[model samples]
Structure formats: structure tokens, C-alpha cells
Target: MSLLFLLVAWSATVLSCALLCRAALAAARALPPAPEAAGDIAPDPAAADRHASGLTLYEMAYLSGGPHRLADVVLVLMAQKRRLLLADTGWATVVDPVGTDAVERAALTAIGPEGQRHIPAVRDALVGDAAVRRVADRLETQGLAQPAAVRPGIGGAVRLVKGSALVTLLSAVATYWTAAPGADSGQVLIWFTVPQILTLGLWAVARFELHPYSDWATVAGERRLPATTGSRDAPDAPGTPPGSLITLALRGPTALTDPSLRAALHSSGA
Candidate 1:
């Protein structure tokens, strides 16, 4: 009867692990299809001069940087217009008293008291600000961003399921050894390994299946955005590309060489 109980626990845990994976996959599938960008930003010639085949700065940022790229957006925007200064100390200085828009206002407000405020401090303040959130949503609606996880509760559920598997495996092993004083427990302990193996396998599937949707850029954007790293001369342009201002959303001041342009793109530096 004790051996039978161990088998049942092992089988049930494995089955539950499989169900957890299946449910997660099914939930991922149930999410709405990736919506087309489709006039979500209402194109204006003055507000935008389209390139990268008509994608916006925000779109390019999404492509290169993910949703967290909003920090770059604020930094680049203020730096470009000479409203703020990023110093080597990872602190920001407000040069201009005003912000031109909601995103700008939110960023400016994020740097409280504005005397060389720390970078991480500013990021924490701005990261969850509602205005910043609105812009992020706009990028998503434009289809520049992948659909966000509509159901984010899977993470905790995953942890719980994994915990249950671990516990059941331990319990089975202990019960087996306790039931017999002289008998070897080696064969009974085989069941102990089953839950651990199943947990790893199911987690792998979930990682692969769910990653694409949760990322900020769609598959296309990730490929389309320039692959340049920091402070590198853009191979094609002299001085800087006018569109480089737009690129600032993803690349920051890295590509700019002109002292004025670099100053404008600066978020933080030595």
C-alpha cells in the first residue's frame, strides 16, 4: 500500500505538471492576434517624418529597446532639446524649467528637485508614471510592440506547481524509506527524480512559447532596428543623420559626434 501511494503521488505530480504547461500554452494561444499598427498614432507630417519605412521614434525604440526603452525616450528627448543634462556621475540636471508634453513632463517630474539627481532614482520615479504608461500603450496599439501579457498570473502559478512537485517527491522518498528498516530504498527513490525532470521540461516549453509576446518589440522590429552599440560612429553618415534624432530612442547618444548633437542626445556620461 505504501509503494502504491508513492506511485500515485509521483504520477499525479507528473500529470499536474503536464497540465500546468498545457494550460499556460493554451492561455498564450488565447491571447488576441498581434494587432496591426493601423493609425494608432494618427500620422502627422509635422509631428513625424517617417523613415525605417514609416516607423516612429517610439516604434524604433520598441524595436531596439523594449518597453523599458521609454527611459531612453525621455532622456533623448530632453537632451536633444537642451532641456536637461546628463552628467558622468549618473545624475541628471534640469537645464530648462519646462517640459513640452506629457511624456516630457513626466520625465522632468521624475527628477525631483533637479540638482544632479541619480539616474536610478529618476528611473524608479518615471518607470511607472501614468503618462509614460500611456505612451507605452500607444506604441503597443501601433503594433510596434508585441501584445503584452494580458494574463500575467502564470508566474506565481508556475512557482506553486513547481513547489508542489518538489514536496511530493520528497514525501514519496521519505515514506518509502520509513516503511522498511532493512530493505534498500534505491528502487523506490527512482520516483523521486520524476518530478524534478518533469518540472525542468515543462518550464523549458513555457519559456519558449511565451517569450515572444511579452517582449517589447515584435519579431520584425527586433530585426529592423539598427544593431549599433554605444558611441560608435555610424558607418554611413557624416556628422549625424537628421533621423539620428529619431534613432536616439533606441541608441541614445551613442552615434552622435557633433558636440552640440551629442550634448542633445546625452542622458548620462563621463
Candidate 2:
């Protein structure tokens, strides 16, 4: 009966770990899609001219009646722009080239040894105008160019899932096997516990390697509105939208009372 219980516990723990790892992988892949620049209500001809002059204006504007969560949306938009430019404009070609061994060696020397050698293939694809058009079409279809924000809670949840995987694995091994401390069971437990303990210790030693706050700050920075030469207080001034979808959903006096709405407002600096 004890063995059966141990086996069941071990199985459950392993299953849980697997689930956590899956969740983390999914979260990593599910980063918010890039934000589409709203159709310039009045196209600034100068904006196009500026681009021609090699000046890029990364603007942040609050959509009328949209969510005030500027930070998350800004980051997504910046990432999106980079993806579009890199994946479509052949920037990769200038940085990395394909086919020629000499070119590859030169690139490796410039980018350092850790650079991905496969990047050259991606650059080659980008250089083809047809490929660029196809990639743009795919981005539109996938809604990857749409503006969306990532929430802090969601980010935290992803991190938790990643951390829990190891914990679950350890718990599984501990729950299983009947060997006593002095017996074979004890030996197996020691083997399992030692590695995890060491890992935990290493994590503590390298705690500074983790940069959760900086990551959050980076996301926030991406969303920051550029300073305008004109008035800062104007309604049309560049800023995050005043209200989010969640805020609009909770109509009337209850809007402030809704927990989710309140949380969104707090995080978004609305």
C-alpha cells in the first residue's frame, strides 16, 4: 500500500511539473502582438520625409477612449516594429549574410562567437522582396501587427509556472520510493534532494542574474510617451488611452468597484 501511494504521489508530482513547464513555454510564445500605428487621421507628409532623412519617430499616442495602459502597449509596438523591419526590410543582410564562407567568417568576427550562424539564412529570405511581402501578409493575418498590452499579473504567472516546474519534480521524487534514510530508499532520496538543494543554493548565489524589475521597467519604457514641443496637458497630447476595455465593460458606479477594472487602472497608471 505504501509503495502504491508513493508511486501515485510521484506520478502526480511529475505530471504537475510537466504542466508547469508547458504553461511557461506557452507564455513565452504568447507575448503580445505588435501594435499597428493608427491610420494617421491627417497624414503628416513631413513624417514620410523624416523617414527618408533617416529619422525615426517612435510615437506613443493614447487612442481616444482607449485603455490608459501606455507602458505595455508601447513595448509591444516597439517589438512589433523591430520584427517587421528585421523580418521584412533585409536589415539582417547588413548584419549577417549567407552562402559565402568568407562573408560568414567576417560576420562571425564582427558579431562575436556567440552569434547564431543560422541568422544568415533568415537574412537571405528578407532580401527577397517577394518574401518580405509574404511575411507582411502573414503578420497581418496572424494579427501580430495589432496593438495589445501584456499585464503584470500575466507576466508574474508565467514566471511562477517556470519556477514551480523544478519544485514539482523534486516533490515527485520525494513522495515516491520506500527506502529508509539508511537504506536504498534513503540513498535515492539523497540523490534527488542534493541536486535540488544545490540548484536552490545556486539560485540564491546568482539572484542578481534575475532581472524581473528591469524587465518590467523595459516594458514600461517602451510605452512612455515622447515629449511634445507643444502643451503636455492637451487632450490630444500623446499619452495612453484614458480607459481600457475592462473599464468600459463595467459601466456606471460599479466600474470603480470592479476588482479587475481597478487592478487594470492601477497597473496602467490611468
What shift in Å separates residue 127 of candidate 1 from its native position after superposition?
3.0
lDDT of 1 by residue, 1-270 (tens): 457757766675666676566646655464446655546555533234445446655556655555446566666567768898766546778999687766677778888764557666676677688775665566556544545563333544466566766766666766675877787777767766676567766666655644333245544444344543222233432454544555565555564454654553343431
- The clash numbers for all candidates, in the given order, read 5, 4
TM-score of candidate 2 against the unseen true structure: 0.26
Residue lDDT tens for model 2, 1-270: 334544544454444445434533443454444433435133433234222212112112221111222222222222233321122221221333222322222333433344332333432322333422332233223332212232233335434433643664545455454435545454444444443444444344324322231122222222232332222233322342344222221121123443543443344333
Worst lDDT 10-window in candidate 2 = 58-67
Error of 2 at 233 (Å): 28
Which regions of candidate 1 fall more than 4 Å away from where they truly are? 1-30, 44-55, 59-68, 97-102, 112-118, 142-183, 212-270
Which residue pairs come into collision in candidate 1? 37-142, 79-264, 80-264, 88-269, 231-254
lDDT against the true structure, per candidate, is 0.58, 0.32
Q: Please give the range of 10 consecutive residues that has the lowest summed lDDT in model 1.
A: 228-237
Q: Clash number for model 1? A: 5
